[model samples]
Target: MSLRPVVDEHECALHGDCAEVAPQVFRIDDVAVVIGTGPDELIMAAAESCPSVAISVIDESTGEQVYP
Candidate 1:
């Protein structure tokens, strides 16, 4: 499955957890930014690691949210 990650800037605390979990996929600047594609599991892991719950994962095939 193709996963797309969206970062909610307002909710982000700039903790860099998401980027730490998946550096290839996320970068930390003012907030976490989706930088590239990664394995489904890795993407989900990154989203789940966000302390502020700022990252949302979507299943590209279904256009449905798969992670909180």
Candidate 2:
């Protein structure tokens, strides 16, 4: 899996929990959150810390998905 991060804008509350949980995977900017590498391990942490359950993790290489 190559790894990918999908954000649900409607579900996100801009709390920055994702960034806090995994800085390398999630970053907060002026407009929206972003993912740099989207590794499964880090992205998983971010998703777990997300209070709003807005972050979804996906593996592009293998199509392996992480459940939130």
Candidate 3:
């Protein structure tokens, strides 16, 4: 499954938790940015670690939301 991580700019507060939890998948700057590809587990972990729920993981193959 190809999981893609996307950051919701409106909800992101630059907390960096997503980056801390999965640096390979997320990066902190003005807001969280999806930097590169990673395991589905890591991508989902990054999304779940966001305190603001700014990060969302989508299964590109299925068009399904994988994280809250």
Best-matching candidate per lDDT: 1
Model with the higher TM-score, candidate 1 or 2: 1
What's every prediction's RMSD, in angstroms?
Answer: 0.6, 2.1, 0.9
Per-residue lDDT for 1-68 in model 3, tens only? 99998899999999899888888777777888888998888888788888899887899999999787
Alpha-carbon lDDT, every model: 0.91, 0.74, 0.87
lDDT of 1 by residue, 1-59 (tens): 89999999999999998888899999888877888999999999999898888999999
Candidate 3 CA-lDDT value: 0.87
Question: Number of clashing pairs, model 2?
Answer: 1
What tens digits encode model 2's per-residue C-alpha lDDT throughout 16-49? 8888777876677752367577556776777778
Clashing pairs in 3: none
For candidate 3, give the lDDT of residue 27: 78
| Superposed Cα deviation of residue 28, candidate 2 (Å) | 2.1
* TM-score (C-alpha) between model 2 and the true structure: 0.75
